[model samples]
Target: MQNTVTIGKQAEQYAYQLLLQQGLQIIEQNWYCRQGEIDLIAQTNDTLIFIEVRYRTRSDYGNGAESVHYHKRRKIISCARYYIHTHPAVEKCMIRFDVFSMSRDSAGEFSSHWIQDAFQT
Candidate 1:
């Protein structure tokens, strides 16, 4: 069985491909700072997106996106602020928070849902 970290990495990779297919340019992955980690950073023509990737194998409680509660959103927002403070190049762009959620079906296939502007700073 794969560990949680391994599963998360796979989910992020899958989310990465999905974003690429949608023509979003990937700026960074697993970006880390003292605030926290942002799973993926991508750019659109006029927007800089900070993405949070979540994965779940069971829907016992809720789906992946639903798990990004208030505290998590706060952390992601704080981290995004730190990111902007450090990366001046993207400072002028519109900032958006996104969630790339993944889940495994009983057949073991993964399905993804991308929620743009999932939250805000």
Candidate 2:
């Protein structure tokens, strides 16, 4: 079995490629702060995006995107605030929270979903 970190990295990578395909330029990956961690930070035009990447091998409970509940949203929001506070360059940019998810089907193939403006601050 793959360790949690390994699985997470793979998920993040899958999300990263999807973002790149959509023309978003990645600013940082796995950005950390005391509040929490932001999986991927990217930019598009004049907007700055904070992304949360979630993956699940099975959809028994819920879809990966559904996993980010209220508390998780709050943590991401707080971390995004901290990121803006520490990075003056992004202070003037429009901020958006996005979620990218991947799930494996019975055939063992993964399908991805991207939710833009997934939540608000």
TM-score for all models, in order of appearance: 0.96, 0.93
Question: Which clashing pairs does model 2 show?
Answer: none
Q: What lDDT tens digits, residue by residue, belong to model 1 across residues 97-118?
A: 9999899878877799999999
Residue 109, candidate 2: Cα error in Å is: 3.0
- Cα lDDT listed for each candidate: 0.92, 0.91
Candidate 1 least-lDDT 10 residues: 101-110
Query: Which ranges in model 1 have alpha carbons more than 4 Å from their true place?
Result: none
lDDT of 2 by residue, 1-121 (tens): 7787887788789889879989999999999999999999999999999999999877788988899999999999999999999999899999999999887677766678999999999
**How far off is residue 88 in model 2, in Å?**
0.8
Error of 1 at 34 (Å): 0.6
